[model samples]
Target: MSRLVACLVLLALPALAAEPAPRRPVHTYSIVARDPVTGELGVAVQSHWFSVGATVPWAEAGVGAVATQSFVDPSYGRLGLEMMRAGRSAQESLAGLLAADGAPGVRQVAMVDAQGRVAAHTGDRCIVAAGHVVGEGFSVQANMMERDTVWPAMAKAFREAKGDLAERMLAALEAAEAQGGDIRGRQSAALVVVSAKSTGRPWVDRRFDLRVDDHAQPLVELRRLLTLQRAYNAMNEGDLALERKDTDGALAAYGAAEKLVPDNAEMVFWHAISLVGVGRVDEAVPLLQRTYKADPRWRELVLRLPRAGLLPDDPKLLARLTGAKAVKK
Candidate 1:
């Protein structure tokens, strides 16, 4: 009977052994930074994963920015921000996250607090070429990259780049790509920047929140989106100037926006309309003519403006806008 029991136990040994756990590799790279001069915080990321930014990036006005990737537990983003907001330093917040997490070896996360303090953690079990580079006011982290040089390249580029926080952060991303980004290739990207002071309004405090949910060349698309965002921001400022009755300010802002994106037909059309709305019909006439010359659809929209109440009901103004000059009183 003893021999039979021993044989039975030997048979069950294979079944009792634990299986290897699964790996959830985010396989992404990112930067979390704070502008020393402005105190603004920013986070940017690119990954083969769908809507990578929606999970990997998090930031709060006057608190800190966090990027959590590689078997991403979005809870790290929320909890990290909560701890930072509650006065924890970047390192402390990271430690808290690691302590609470059951599987710390598969995670890669970075954080930068409002004071420019930076901290990062790259799990031991993260994919090859996975690590982080802590910088003066930022941290660059990557996992499952094509080479181990990606994070270092990002650090060098970010430190050398001459510009504002956003520009520098973007430079870091460009550098990462130049060094060979993800092992799987690029899919989605995102960027978010917040002001140093909390305005008590989420929208007001958020300076930029741009994302490319799905794209073939996500980094290039991301850069283009950033440029477009700047031009649109100028347009918004111009609109606000118009609201305050600062006509010169409005025109200057609008012209700045147009200059940023000279070929944007919609921008030119709106500027012309705003010009007419301000009783500067003479100034608007030439711009409207130029836009209609380039895009006949602008003229169609102009013709519909009267019925839509977007433009005055004056036929003279309508005629000039449409280049017909049919003045009917």
Candidate 2:
């Protein structure tokens, strides 16, 4: 997308609300799920707490995802994944972490193993309304909620929701909020999903990590970011198709990306450039003209392309593309 699209979104962000004077207690609702078909593991969370996901959620490709909340022991995230990686089931991993921690009574946690088996705990010491709901391939947990129905609502939402793992996890978060989310209010949210198989390359294995550090409507912002992510994914696929000389596939990918963000000038500029690469200059002309009219800088960029060998070196093509007078050669 054009830098303008991103700038507009950024500019639309509201000023940060005042955070707690001290890093005091925070409570939240979150879900960890494994996609049955893709084996993709994901966790989504929202809280009345600032940067809630920074400390609350963790995942490792081919291992499991973890959310350690309530008294919030960050170790559970690290240790649970480690234990599971060492061959422990989700139950065993959680048990081992709770056993090692002296303050288990005050902590709440959940884990979904690589195989989809889930285990969770809600300590009696966690704030009132704290509890968890375990369902097939997923678990929803909440504490200090507006009502005890928060976790249960999340459970039902996950069960009934349709789409990819991220969307379902998001639905659960939305359900939690609808049922009465954090008694205090809303702040930050995050989503993390990883591939089921260990690719050895961490970056390649991990997918869809998004966060809204602090926002009045964190979930709403999270959804917008997710939508933007899908467009970029389509753009990436289009790039790869072009690399393989699959013109039809490339165009289809660009078309899908454009459809996602119809007004994204940057996306359209690249789409037009791609058409030019495929010798579809006539079809690309209108797109380029619209792009250039909005910002002549795009025309300057196109003029530079021939020097970079990214576009045809022909003087006629360059003049037509840039709307510049033909250079007498």
Candidate 3:
């Protein structure tokens, strides 16, 4: 009986020693910065886990961007934006918030203002190899890096890269990866860029908002999407020119956009509008008819246009433009 008990005790001891401690909640860490020339704010992050976009990356059109990660308290994102809006400097805002948090040691964050003031924090009790670096108008922070060089590499990329705000942010992500990112591997990535001018229109105010929810190669796919976004912008410019009756300018812009994305329905629809603006009604009729047939709501809009003074007063011209029966309002 004593020998059997001794063997059982030996087996139990090894099992207990091998067991890992129960994991506490995870917090995210990231870099937030502003562009001096454009005043565009951005945030970039990498995590050992999946789909970090939900907990990280927050921004309002006119307010500063925020990245709340690493044993995270999500409230920091909202509170930081409020603090910045309330006239607190980035440094003061971060310091005040972290000082009040019970788990400061596990949180990491960085913020930059439109005036180029920057602030960053990396809690002492954070996982090993976590640190942050801040420079003129930029900040880079990382946790679970393979070495201390991750943040410095990111800082260098942000300063040296020549591109728009989104490109600069992407460079930082690439730099972190080159310096041994997440100490695990990549899963997801996201980028968002908002114009300094709100224009009171949310859809048009945001310049670039792209996400790679789950991918083996997120950054590469993100670059491709940005290219498509530029093409769409061209299409919008063409539509605006058409509205002003600048037929030549509208054609040039639409041609450039269509060359980039030829199959897009909006591009095709707007190009047809440009043709019509220049009195090419015969050419416009077929394209508009195709679009109307594909979407019945568009047909309804066409029927309502005569009453709104958008369509010609002549019944014959209206009938020729829309083959379907027109109901006089």
Query: All candidates' TM-scores?
Result: 0.86, 0.88, 0.72
Q: Residues 278-320, candidate 1, lDDT per residue (tens digit)?
A: 7888888888878878978888788776675556889877887
Q: Return the TM-score for candidate 3, rounded to 2 decimals.
A: 0.72
Winning candidate number (TM-score): 2
CA lDDT of each prediction against the hidden true structure: 0.85, 0.83, 0.70
Give the deviation of candidate 2 from the true structure as CA RMSD. 10.7
Q: Write model 3 residue lDDT over 8-65, tens digit each, in one string.
A: 3344344434552223334333567787888877776656556777667776666677
Q: Number of clashing residue pairs in every model?
A: 0, 1, 6
Candidates ranked, most accurate by TM-score first? 2, 1, 3
lDDT of 2 at 105: 83
- Candidate 2 segments whose C-alpha is farther than 4 A from its true place: 1-24, 307-309, 327-329
Better of 1 and 2 by TM-score: 2
What is candidate 2's lDDT per residue for 236-299, written digit by digit as tens?
8888887787877777888788788877777787788788888899988888888887888998
The RMSD of every model to the true structure, in order and in angstroms, is 9.8, 10.7, 12.6
